[model samples]
Target: MMHPSESCNHRKSLFNTMNRFIGAVNNMDQTVMVPSLLRDVPLDDVGDVKTVTDDTASNGSACFQQDADMYSSYVLLKSIRSVMEWGVLQGDGRGKERVGESEDDDLEKQFHFHLNGLHAVLSKLTRKANTLTNRYKEEIGCGNL
Candidate 1:
């Protein structure tokens, strides 16, 4: 029942939002450095508690956390993309007719294809996160004793 222009505008807004989300994620990716918790520790410490001098362990933990955040963002974007695709598919027939059946079908196919690609990327990211976590565990375990 929605007007064609309104539907178009809605889709455009969704696309804009998606772009913004991706941009934010990319920006975060570029600056994904883990801060050292030991930096705040005072040098005047009294007892036998040693300072964490190993930067690798802190950096590894930070990288794992960043990967986890990226994975979460990707999952959210995938859900949003799915909803947008559904909206496009369920739009009034008038818009579909105006856009031409073949064109609409092609657009849908492309959207699905891109979505599948996103899924694959997410899968790879998940595997990388798992590897990072395992590495972190090993490092921590070794460093503790």
Candidate 2:
């Protein structure tokens, strides 16, 4: 039988965070019908991938200039979801890199730090996806999201 601790660990794994991100992206894809409206619409932090990904109410409207657009964000979201499923180095790099015992402490600290960042990014992406869907609905004159 699987240990309870192991089960709990699995829930907190990066895979879990990735799964949630995928779901949000999938929903965004389905909700967006006229994607042309999303084109050239500024968005993100990275040049081609820049925009706001906050989980709270965003100031992202079609009014101001930004980095990426909703369309690009949508595409990026889907691409990331694909990568999580297919994984990095899908064909190779399956072997593990063992860390020295002396580095274990640093590794643990780094892992937690990166994990927290991952959680924050995922939350932002999920919120962005939902926001895009809601915006599209509003454009189409749909009921309250």
Candidate 3:
């Protein structure tokens, strides 16, 4: 079992990291505006404000979703890598080599397996994000504005 002090330290670290991420996400909408392709941005009208809001909300939500998904995938991959690295360091990586279970040999196979799964998820997310981006571009409604 983890000592009380160790547990408290771990919790504090997690909370700090989480707070930073939350702060960034909360301000993302204002930071991300229309693309530079539209140089004639009109901020003088209420209509423009409405359009910007709609576009920003959609795009920001899509971005946050993609970021969250990718972060989760990255976390999973890193966790697996850390475990494998630790096992290698301990010289007990091979669960049962004589039984044809070579750790080094299977490492690549397992890594690829996990990587392929992550790739599939990221691919889907990219497609979705691209769609959202395209929609935002369309909302800009400026073929040459």
Candidate 3 lDDT by residue in tens digits, 1-49: 9999998666545344344333433332232263343233322222211
lDDT of 2 by residue, 71-119 (tens): 7667666766676777655333343556655555688888889898988
lDDT of each candidate versus the true structure = 0.41, 0.67, 0.39
lDDT of 1: 0.41
Worst 10 residues of 1 by lDDT: 37-46
TM-scores across all candidates? Answer: 0.30, 0.61, 0.28
Model 2 clashing residue pairs (backbone): 43-50, 43-51, 43-68, 44-50, 44-51, 45-50, 45-51
Per-prediction tally of clashes:
0, 7, 0
Residue 90 displacement in candidate 1 (angstroms): 26
Error of 3 at 12 (Å): 40
If the candidates were sorted by their lDDT against the true structure, best first, what order would they fall in?
2, 1, 3
Please give the RMSD of candidate 1 to the true structure: 18.8
Clashing pairs in 3: none
